[model samples]
Target chain A: MASIVWLAPAVTPATEAGDDPLLPPFGAELIVDFDLALSPYSEGSDDQQEVFRAFALGLHAGRRWHRWGVGLAVEGTLWRTLDGRGEDDWFGALHTGLEGSVLSAGGRIRTRVGGGLALLLEGTALDSAGGAGFYVDLRPAGLRWALDDAVVGFDPLTLFMTLPDAGGIPLVDVQYRLCIYAEFGR
Target chain B: MSARTYPLLLAALGLMTLPAAAHGYSLQTAVSDSCHERITVSSLDVLLDLVDDVSGFEVPDDPLLRQLLGRLQFPGTEDASLQVRFVMFSIIIGVRSPDTDGHSTFNLAALRRLHADPAPRGQYAHALRGPGDDGIAGDLAAVDGTIAAILDEVQTGASLSAGGVIADKPAYLDHYGVVDVPVALFAWHVGRALHALQDAHAHMIWDAEVEHIVGVLNYIDAVEGRLEDADGLAHSDALDDCHRDDVAPLVEAATRRTRALTLAIVEAARTRDGAALRAGLAPCVDDATDRDACGWIVYNPPCRAAIRAGDTDAVEAVCCDDANDFCGSPYAAIARQEAVGPYLGCATAPAGQSGGWAWGLGLLGLAWLGRRRRFAAPTALALLALARPAVAAEADEAADAADAPPRLSVVVEGHGSALDDRVDAAILSPAFGYGVRAGWQTGRWRFGLHVDRDYWVSVEYGARVDGGVLDVAAFAEGLFFDDYVRVAFALGTSTLMFDTELHSTGNTGVFSEIRPLGLRFPLGERLWLVLDPFTTTVVMPAIELDDRLPSLRKVQHRTIVGIEGGFL
Candidate 1:
């Protein structure tokens, strides 16, 4: 007497969430992210800080499980960069990817993981401090000689847990982290 | 007989004065109380002797039997002697924290509930209730007369883990019965906890905690008259020799085991060693109320509030102290409030804040006008028929009725590498890898573990430029979402130590995943997106890649930071 249909959620009879074509197409989310990384490279100064900033914009195709759903948006960040010698330096890399989640249950909980080519923009500002730099002087060299790989962790996509406008810096140290996570994909 | 040889000690201690023939009810109370502490291998041996004469049961030999039986040869099982042991175990698993006024109040509440509501309450009792409630029913599946309810809370199955269903399993099955479910589930968890030990990381449970587990299990065997009765299990005839010569000894051994470990637990707890507590009580910390018993019940109003605010100092103040306080035991819900909070940050938002799309859809259906309207009744009925999807989706979210899943899972992932070196002494072609995942699922939540393995392809120390291998990897992640807000936590293993002159050590520096929040409108045919903005954290692992293995060329570690987009 009771039935469970998977496609029944986002569609009237067949369409899924995020698959909708008409509803105001997903808006591009311009993410201006800044990250301060401490290389676990013991051979080098463990305290060596690696600061990076990037802007990417991309939207995803819409999805619908049982009812009417929304599509994903693709966004690319502006000019991504890093901090060298305690000063903000230009990031000679390009980043592009996708993000979205399920529209069921009154809210949306996202699970996002994406990657793209990161090549040096060729010309960038010089590091005034003499601490650490990329492409020309200190760390590594060129776009191919630059840092490349997919870096990932959880990103709060909804307002309930999002940080309030604060960015570029954090409120605490490494000890602030508690959870243990893993990443893998060849 | 083992019992006859130990009568002097039992009698000397006044424990043998009771009529040994009818000690069922009495021994049950005694052993149950005694089981609350740290049990050791040596103490458990003697516990078997105490229960040797009981007639109805026999010792069981499970997959973990030999390991458990090997532990029961010690002495001591008095209630007072084992109290400390039980409390310590309670604390590690988030059950009986010192915060509940120095008592395993949650467990105590369970005892009260068991005593208070002995009658069956149907499946409703298994629903995911809050603290102090025994969501798992007492009647676990019977696999040869042994207690297996412990598996009811497992959340480690494959589908369960991907779906984040392990955390909710135990509470869901509070009404039904799953014989091997609990054991299989806990086994995976304990294995994962143990793996953490090898990684030199801190978690809910550790390897050192083993000394205490064997102790409690030993006590259980001793009190239960474990195995002796098995060989002699010839209730078929009166004087079967297997009953006398074979089974009796096993029974005695099991009884003694229970007594010894109970005493050991008590001793360890008195010393207040963090490791000892971890080993002694991590098992019972399976539920929210169990969190109370484990003494993880954090009552510091300000500390708790600060934890919510993501205050670092407050987290340190409350969690750093590993003594016999409310949060001293790693078992309390409060203990994980910060560091692991996001993963455990469950969502309980109300439905239809803006009213379900059902209303809008409903209005659209009413606007129809046709001659089929002549049979308006049938049209209305058909519209309602189409309403099943909306209603079912809402109902599934609410879980209006009963019954949930009993999940079990096992996983193993590994990676190997190669490297090379040149005249520049620059390393080329290097690699490293490690992966271990396991979980248990029960009801709507899933509890799981993700272990990380590091594989450095090679390390090339060059004169001109210095850069090595790096693997952008994720170590662990916990997520909960199904028509609700989901908290996803990830641990990134970003190692750039093996930086060699070789090809490239994959270091996806940007570790990020999307956590959904707010009401979501269905995205497309098979997807959805949270309607609001969310937050996330990024991390770079502290891996030292200076050491190189014998068989490789250069440091080679290439991997993704984490996965995002679509259902995984």
Candidate 2:
């Protein structure tokens, strides 16, 4: 027999209160993530290195069947530093994509690994002029903890972020994110 | 795009796709469940279980899927796989439902044609338009007609006979179609119809502000009578007249009507009575209350009025004022003030700069104080270790208590990083910072206090104020993947010296920081090099400073690396 404990079946307001108690199979998540990327190789960097920081706020809704879940997410990323070449020009990206996750949990912690394809609705830092393109992302590491009434987690290693905003710019960016989510209904 | 367009887009999207709507409406799953339960209790689950086991048409336990498939006639043949029937079921239900763009899968015209000719091909005509100025006449009609048609065909057997809700024979067992069983078919049509009704309710109550998270809180508060003001509709030039707190009654009315219609349909299907079926559906058509309540006309009028006015300025003003109200709201007045303060710049205070902090230290302090009193495990562990030699002398005594619990371990960590103090211009040039973390852990979970102090390694105090920043945070850390990785978030206060011409303010600000990526490389027993490569901090002041001063309130982000170890 598999013994299951319905942790926070009603409310766990560690961070913020008024979250729905029932862990509905289908949910909408509002995530505010801080993305820090270090590109060892870049287009026009003299030092052969670029450090970028961005604040990504995304809205995603999906249905979960057991451990596997699939959904669509639209992320609006505001880049604080792009290219890191003293350009001082900030950029923004709107990434709309299909995201899939496989999650497993033990005790109060749940670990998830997710990846998907994203359409860059906006542009990259190098373009200076914003544009859109396609990219593939892989998050090998993601973890969620039951924090009070809300669930908080982050995808640490988001690799192969090739939004390809501008032509002839071969760049690879790795992203890290911190997210807080609340489940609405069952 | 104009700011006005954003709110309108949100409003439209919120009304269309209630499932994905950000506002905290709990009706989506409620309606979905009520529809599913109606069939599950009517022997639909038993039939599904048998079909799943025999014909391999099994699907996962999903609420929305269950509702959609509840009315499906399971094909008892190898040709119709689970995927095939599932897709067919989705096509039948999805065509009438709202999509992400707030449009139905099929338009009223196409749905009417599909209802006239029951087939799967016509279910794919993408509806580009939603309800018009007066609402679509044929949209709900076609849905009802199709539902009735399917239920009528499902009840059609070799001969119309009465007994135990069609348990005598299974009409769908031989045919590869959707309309065969009374239980399954009734569940499906009723579920779909109920979803439509609930969707209609979503549009009526979801005011302008229900577009985002803060707006959702306001809507919930308003509905619960916590807020005395009229709903967000009052602020909207479009929906001001529709503002009311009668959402409960409206929803209750709709729910009762839909449930009654479902039960009546089930009874008619059981007896194979065609007239009773039509009579059951009469409420959906003739009953003025249900019809009026379950139509988008409630929103279309005001929405069209706003659309015709084309008053972008008015829309923006309302949206901005709503944003202001959300910021000034009692619930959001605490942790969210710093975040919303900048957006409220158009209303209050200048748009230049705004800075404030949250006193997360008090919360952290309380937790630490509580932890100190609750956990005597550390002291007990020390005593146990000291008494090990004496206990070893008495073998019998030691053997009696052999099943002892694991000892709690104390962890301490410290690291250094480089900082770019952009806010204090040239005040802390070439800054370097160090952080320390101390906690007690038993197994995978750890609770601790983290302190980080940033000072100018090389300072040139040339008219620029230079002072060290001290940050104190409390966090919960969890080790996973066989203890190879750890993740943690810290909530605390950042005390920084704000040197202005008038006063020297060493203010404490609130912050929530997370180290999402931490990998442990063990160098020796009980010692590990815990490399946290990526750490981000969200900083704000605990107390509000004078907004008349320069806008010092800006969201701060930093990246730091640290090393940690554990010693019991």
**What is the TM-score of each predicted model, taking all chains together?**
0.21, 0.27
Q: Report residue B106 deviation for candidate 1 (angstroms).
A: 56
For model 1 the local lDDT of residue A144 reads 7
Off by over 4 Å in 2: A1-140, A144-186, B1-432, B455-468, B497-505, B545-560
Candidate 2 chain B weakest lDDT stretch, 10 residues: B168-177
lDDT, candidate 1, B1-568, per-residue tens: 0111223323532221111110010111111221112222233333234222222122233322222223322234343222222212222221111111111111111111221122222111211111121101110111101211111221221112222112211110000110011122222232222111111111111112211100000111121122122111101111111123422322232233233223322333233333433332233343534221232111233443554677777655643222323233322222122121111111111222211232343345334422232322323223322212231344443232212322443334344322111111111222334444344544433345554445432111111222322334342222223322323233444444433322124443323221222232232322333322222222232222422111122222222122112221
Query: What is the TM-score of each candidate's chain B when compared with the real chain B?
Result: 0.17, 0.27
DockQ of 1: 0.03
Model 2 scores a TM of: 0.27
Distance from true location, Cα of B561 in model 2, Å: 3.2
lDDT of 1 at B392: 31
Clash totals, every prediction: 233, 17
Candidate 2 DockQ, CA atoms: 0.03
